[model samples]
Target: MNTYRLQQLLYEETDIEKIQKKKHNFIIDLPKYSFNYQNGLLTLNDTSFFKKNEYLFINKHNRYAACPKHCYQFIELNYMFSGKCTEKINGEKIDLKKGDILFLNAGSKHAISSLGKNDILITFLIKEKNIKVDLLSQTKGFLNISMENITPFFTDIFRDKQYHVFRNNEPLSFEQTLNNIIYEYYFPQIYSAEIIKCNLLKFFLLTARRSEKSCPDSQLEPHNSILLSQITEEINKNFKSLTLAVIAQKLNYNKNYISNFIKNQTGKTFTELINIRRVAEANKLIKHTNYSIAQISELVGFSSKTYFYSEYKKHFDHLPSHDRQYSAAEFLKV
Candidate 1:
């Protein structure tokens, strides 16, 4: 699709927006807000616009609409197609420019400021079950920095009830990938589901690359950056057999010093980091392999089955066996 067609598709007003506009009183020019709330917050339980069997829904933000404090049961990704917008995610105010992407994990509390007529924000709502898990592996090396700066949307370990913002530095390639997703989802045809998945994967990779490019090394001290990078490489490669002592011996640093540094830098202890990696790997195995829960837990370096189960449930909110079956069922249904 050409740029004009894409713009036309996104800019076309929706029925709800039209009704919202008609309800506006120009005399006072007050901001439009949704009072659909429970317990002082607007928590959406389902995709109001999604059709049956539709897991992905896309739409433009209503112009001049100011959403009140709210959260959703599914992932929400917003792209600043034009103009600018501001939002408060978990009490942090963020200013988003054109070509920016904001990923709000499920259950993250946030509120958006009113958008002007020129601001064009496109949002994609994806059910939690439909979000791909393999994206965690992509955040291993240089892209790991992306996680620290902009965070990730697809991992159970890092989905800490937070919203991540990424600037699309390479707009040409990144926007094209996003546009492909919009086109496929908006005008679905034969195999559109598969096509949209491919586009979404590409879009995520582009977001990772953009995050890497946009994140400046100056954010972290020079030595801290190098050490963090090395530490992450070791953890990613050796988490299956890794320990604080083992990592310290390999890096030729005092175990206590390395442990303290890791905790201070990442806000996670050495053991916590290892457990995060192990549980993430176990999740991947549960989705892709036939290994039993015990075997998968053992393979990821957990010694006690009970401990592994606890950690897995803590991160994923599901038992390993149940998650495997549920994942399979979700795959077949999709």
Candidate 2:
């Protein structure tokens, strides 16, 4: 099912008052239970929940107060399926809209605001041990680190302790990948665990790539960063007919200055940057859709098929047809 339908089903099946009542019962009924910040780790004490065979657990954020300011023992990947919510992290309030993802590491303390009726927030809780095991399994006997050292190793890999927020303007692919994971999680078919792992890895990699672009290093100046963002956004919107002169006139800057600024900031000229963006889109079309190379080239703003092929090869180091064939082979193998 599509994301919209899935969200509709989730909302229809979930009773907000019942969920709130459950939370209230847990707090009042159990004397030892406390969701407060100083109560240490918020261990979800559901015995039947998160089976040992399962690597991930899916939870729906349906309450108005959500949860108290607490932390978990596992990493949580929060995806905004629909509507909006506010996340208070590190003294900053981040307004999250549809298609946004908030990656919270283990032991990170944060709180969420009240969610709207249409707000469909899905949380994917991944066990820290599972991730550490997966990483070490690849190398086998290459490293002799004990279980006690695993958490520190993983922490070193992710040196930035702050939470990460990724804004996905176009969430079609993101939604599709998430749907696959959710499907696999609910319906346990043969090799479903393997499939979920693969899909989650793909989703994580895609988010990491997008995050790198969205949150760049601090070396970029404030003014240049703003200008660079505007330039890229304009190029993405009008790549079909985008040009340095057109961008300069639209942004009220000189053409030469714009060209030089782009080159200096991105390390690529205006034409080169546009070509890169077009070729990237063309690659996606060639792999995911059945569009011919010529048609895909034209769709991505290339006027001549010959020039498109040259630029495509220059960027990807392979012909479009070969790439398509390779992708098809990989899909069949899967």
Best by TM-score: 1
Cα shift from native, residue 97, model 1 (Å): 1.6
Which 10-residue window in model 2 sums to the lowest lDDT? 25-34
Give each model a TM-score. 0.54, 0.51
Q: Can you write out model 1's per-residue Cα lDDT over 1-334, one digit (the tens) per residue?
A: 5678778877776666666567641111223342246655676666364566556788777766677777777888888988999988755688988888888887777777777767888888887553443333334553444332333346632344466777655533566778788887778789877777767666766655555554444368888899999999999999999888988998899999999999877778998888989999999999988888889988999999999988886665457887798889988998
Of candidate 1, the 10-residue stretch with the lowest lDDT total is 25-34
Model 2 global lDDT (CA atoms, 0 to 1): 0.69
lDDT per residue as tens, model 2, 1-334: 3555555566763555466645642231223542333333244432333666455788777554455455666677888878888886644578888778777877666667767567778888777677556644643675565433433323432444456666766542476688788776665689877777667656655655454444444468888888889998999898888988999999999999998888777657899889978988999999899887888989999999999999887665457998899889989999
Q: Give the clash count for model 1.
A: 0
What candidate 1 gets wrong by more than 4 Å, as runs, is: 25-36, 47-53, 133-152, 156-161, 170-173, 210-334
